[model samples]
Target: MSQPQPDPEAPVLRAEGLYAAYDGTQVLCDVNLSVGVGAMLGIIGPNGSGKSTLLRCFAGTLKPTAGRVLLFDTDVATIPVRQRARLVAVVPQHTTTSFAFTVWDTVAMGRHAHLGLMQALTERDIRAVSSALEQTDCIHLADRLITELSGGELQRVIIARALAQEPQVLLLDEPTSHLDINHQLDIAALLGALNADRRLTVLWVTHDLNLASEFCERIVLLSNGHVAADGDPLEVITQRQLAAVYNTELTVMTNPLSGRPQVVITASKNEARR
Candidate 1:
């Protein structure tokens, strides 16, 4: 079966005039974001800045109080539940299983969208799961119970599940938030490789500005539910932008190897003022 080839000029994912609220309080206000096919865009912001909220809207997991989310020319809200799953997959900040399930069985769940009720895993499903395990380097943990895995291990398993969906777009929320340095780099390299190899459109939400700057092709900085800046990392991750949004003394420097900007929180201005 041939998949729909995304238009080069058009964005694979788009958020137009998005406004979301929780308990009568707005979380995302008039947010607009667009990402082309094979592009990796990072959404960065401080806590309560609505980065995750925006991602949830794009994933169709949360309905915006107002405005529409469009995924490849089709309104996400209009797509049926199962069909939508095949088009986009989301890896949330935290995923847990109440009961222990084998890694292989968990990854196989991603194929549910393509299967009928109670249908057995098809040959195609096996191939997809195997490929996902290899890409995530979790093939060794196939028989391990999810309850026995560490945070980093679980994160990779979750991503593998998302990859098994064969989605055109991947939505990630703070994927590296709880990971150690090595695991963080591992996930970043994996995402970069997949994006380059399969032309996967990715929108990732992150609090780590330096990591986002290094991997993301475009960065959208949000402040208090509004888009503060949108451009390349060099344009958005500046000292002035970080200070103003985070209320901290920040130092922005160039990475000699990649020539990308890196942000550093240099001082505790809040403590100094207090």
Candidate 2:
């Protein structure tokens, strides 16, 4: 692939005074964020803090109540859906719909934005799907049924499908929710590699703060419908900030190997008394 354009210019994504809510309840409050080309940004917050809600705005699934979302300095709403699909892909937390399609067929669906309703998979599309499977190390499961695979296997397939979109921006929501520790590490490694090698600009919402700190260049912490903090992972994942947002006591330490922040949840005094 050709070298991605430099980041000296405007950011690939910018949110200014963004506000979003549900059922007349505000979820995000005047959020301002900017993501440069090839940047890896992690979004973390307590439940109902609107990490997913903010992502929906960028994915064009949820319209913002106020403010502007610019893709390449152009309004996101003005971009055609097909054009937007080519620019961004979302890997959801989990997919529960039962479809008996083979893994290859499921992944090929990512190309729909580029093909007619009745169009067959062209050579380019096939190559793209195959390459995505290879990148995620799921090529061996290409012929397997989606319903028959384990959660981790299916997660990789979904990520592969997103990759097949050949998107410049990748948005992942709770990608490791159903995975074990090993799978979590594997997926984190893959994401880090993709960002480093392919220059894929990534926005990830994860509950795993340690993984986020290890893999992301920066992190945005949300709480009570506002951005509580935004900065380098080490700078943002402090014990005070986490305790306040998560409503729990926690110890923050630095990983000696990676030099990233690590969080250890502290037990409540009542529990400790036991």
Give the alpha-carbon lDDT of every model. 0.90, 0.90
- Error at 271, model 1, angstroms: 5.3
Report the lDDT tens digits of candidate 1 across residue range 32-55. Answer: 877789888889999999999999
- In lDDT terms, how accurate is model 1? 0.90
* Residue-level lDDT tens digits of model 2 in 1-274: 1335347476999988999989889998999988899988899999999999999888888888899788888889889999899999999987974879999999998998888878899999999999999999999999999999998899999999999999999999999988999999989899988999999999999999999998888899999879999988878999989988998767999898978899876567327547
With a 3 Å backbone cut-off (N, CA, C), the pairs that clash in candidate 1 are none
Runs in model 2 deviating more than 4 A are 1-8, 268-274
Candidates' RMSD to native: 3.8, 3.1
Number of clashes found in candidate 1: 0
Number of backbone collisions per candidate:
0, 0
Error of 2 at 126 (Å): 0.8
